[model samples]
Target: MAAAAVSSAKRSLRAELKQRLRALSAEERLRQSHLLTQKVIAHSQYQNSKRISIFLSMQDEIDTEEIIKDIFKQGKICFIPRYRFQSNHMDMVKLASPEEISSLPKTSWNIHQPGEGDVREEALSTESQREKETWLLITKWLRNETEEGVKTWQAQPLLLKCQSN
Candidate 1:
């Protein structure tokens, strides 16, 4: 009974949040995305790493276009996700350049990812001292298998949080 109630509450919360997101003006959404992108770029996690992984944003989410471009611009290695819906598996595959992003195929979920057969070096399989992810709507700092912490500016998408994060 408790589990059922918890699930119901979760669903309700998700619905309410999504409705609120939909209510946001397009201009406001874009402005927030731009600010968050700048914050991620200026983040120390981004500055020191040679290789980085990030998500391709959805329409309703914070845009990552600038961040991805900046990765290539700074001459750092970039990795994007390739998800397998059939199983609980996701790989961070190396991306060649910013231009290649558009050519990649889009999944049914409307996310762009490399083709199944397209072989790219998996971040974990490589020998790297640091691996980090700047998520679609959140920025996380990870150290190997253990999570160091997740910092999400999306939770409170405001100009005030931008300076601190």
Candidate 2:
């Protein structure tokens, strides 16, 4: 009963926050998103990382397009999660350019995801074993795995958080 209640409360909070985010004006959203991107780009972890795993932003979330562009410009590899419905798993797909993203089909959720024929690649490769590779993650909120063991950055006051692990 206690667990159920906690879960319900969390769902309610998430819904409310989502509503608030959806209500923001386009200009406000763009401005805030740019600021968030700048903050993430300036972070030492992002500066030093060779590979980054990032999510495609939903309509109400902070936009990641600029960040992705910057990553490519810096010659860093980018990975995005591709959900496989049958196996109920996600595979990281390499995105070489922003144009590649636009060319992909959108999922039912309206987010662009790698479909069949997209070149699948591993975020960590054999070469990465020799050197300690840094990782950066940008998201609206921090999760348990990220919070406990990873270095995370939160873009607070704006209500969206970007994590660098």
Candidate 3:
């Protein structure tokens, strides 16, 4: 009976630790979000990237919509990554406009996803001509502190030549 009791206690401790870890993760996400916002805004590459491709943030570290809104305001061509089932890889989809993003499909976790029609064929053609571009993927630290997380943003933006329409 004593051994069983000890085992139960260990399980309880594990559960508590897991819960605390989740909370810490949440806090870290918030910190990274703030820092990433500042970094993306201040980074010269981000400001100069006329046609930028970004992977959608899966973590709470950054909210993709907020970032998109700021880029939209600057009149930059923003492309967010979408999971392509057939390709088994993420495909960057060009957003028609910021106004249409709110209407995107939502997953069970309430994550917004790009619909099939949101992808522009012309953009795909353009992307095919160029290699992968420099991008950012924000990450968080265990302590939830800004600048403590990973520097996912590239220092220099990749150059690509697109055929004129």
Candidate 4:
């Protein structure tokens, strides 16, 4: 009974906090979001690794350009996720330039994407949806594995759309 009460109180507190945060103004939300992202990057555990694999967050609209650039600056190799329709998951690809990933297309729930291409060119958008702006990426870790002829270390799968055959 004591544990149950504690859990109930915690849930109530959490709900109240969520409600208050949701009531924040759009500008305030953006500011808070930026700060949170900065904090996460600052305290990230993978900072000095030789390679880092980051499965980009789909739900969050945080821009990873600066972070990607920073990774390159550290002389680390990074990778992002590419969705394959033939298989039901994402395939990892090494990133060459931070500026190359111009825009990420929403291909699935919480999954936005920028494909591998030349660093000087931008990824063309094939969709008209405005809410689909965030892109999912997978960074390289210490090593890579060749599974079934595809490369991966630790990354997730499909976003929404399948790769064109």
Candidate 5:
């Protein structure tokens, strides 16, 4: 009974968050996305990161186009998600260049990603030992603190924490 209640609560919270995200006007979303992109690019963590995993934003999510470009301009290795429709699996693959994005086809999710035929290096591979310890997964959401319970999604203007998993 307790498990059922917890599951129901999760569904309700997710619905509420989705509604909140959808409520954001296009202009407001763009404004916030720009603000976040600027902050992430300027952050010391981003400057230090040699390899980073970043998400391709949906229409409702925070835009990451600027950050993607900055990564290439700085000569940092950037990894983006490539979903395998065969199974419910998504892998972080190396993005060769910013220009590579345009030639890629869009998925049903309205995000540009490499097709299944494309071969790229995976982030979890044993190829690079130096990067084994350093990789940041830049997502649309951010946490106030780690190791402790999350305070909120937008807790900080730019929360550039390293993600090991």
Candidate 6:
């Protein structure tokens, strides 16, 4: 009974949050996303990391195009998730340039995903050897409270492990 209640609560909260995010105006969303990108770019972890795994933004989420461009500008490798239907999992594909992203097809879920042939063998091998290094994963969170006050939505970097081995 407790588990069921918790699950229900979580579902309701997620729906409410998604609605709130959808309500954000284009200008406000762009402003917040730019600020968030600036924060990540200025962080030492992002600066030192050689490879980063970042998600392509949906219509309602923070736009990561600027961050991706900056990463390439800084000579860092950028990767995005390419879902595999047979394995029911995602693989990281090296994104050499921002323009390449548009050439990919959209998944059933309406998110852009790289094709199976887009995998980079070199990146896969290097990921295993760099397990000890910090890698950035860009993600979004809702209703998080900060030192200043409550924030409705935020995009931030989360440290993640490399499972390429």
Residue ranges of candidate 6 with Cα displaced over 4 Å: 1-16, 122-134, 142-151, 161-164
Score every model by TM-score: 0.70, 0.71, 0.56, 0.43, 0.74, 0.76
Please write out the lDDT profile of model 5 over residues 1-165, one tens digit for every residue.
698898899899878867777877888678778878878888887888788888877777778888889989999988899999889698878899988888889998788999888888776663663346446545445545656774544513343444434
* Candidate lDDT values, in order: 0.69, 0.71, 0.58, 0.48, 0.75, 0.76
> Listing every candidate in turn, what is its Cα RMSD in Å to the true structure after a full C-alpha superposition?
10.1, 8.3, 10.7, 16.7, 6.2, 4.1
Q: Tell me the tens digit of each residue's lDDT in model 2 across 1-165.
A: 698898899999989878767766788678778878887788777887777777788877888888889989999888887887778677656787888988889887787898866666655543543354536474554323364585433343221222322
Report the alpha-carbon TM-score of model 4 versus the true structure. 0.43
| Highest TM-score model number | 6
- Clash list (residue pairs), candidate 2: none
List the candidate 5 regions with Cα displacement exceeding 4 Å.
Answer: 1-14, 129-131, 139-165
Global Cα lDDT for candidate 1: 0.69
Task: Give per-residue lDDT, candidate 4, residue 140.
Answer: 21
Which stretches of candidate 4 lie above 4 Å from their native place?
1-29, 55-60, 103-165
Ten residues in a row with the worst lDDT in model 5? 155-164
| Residue range 41-73, candidate 6, lDDT tens digits | 898888888888788988888788898898899
- Model 4 lDDT tens row, 108-128: 554645543423211123232
What is the Cα-based TM-score of model 2? 0.71
Per-residue CA lDDT of model 1 for 22-50, tens digit only, reads 76678867877777777777776667666
Candidate 6: worst-modelled 10 consecutive residues by lDDT: 127-136
Clashes of 1: 0
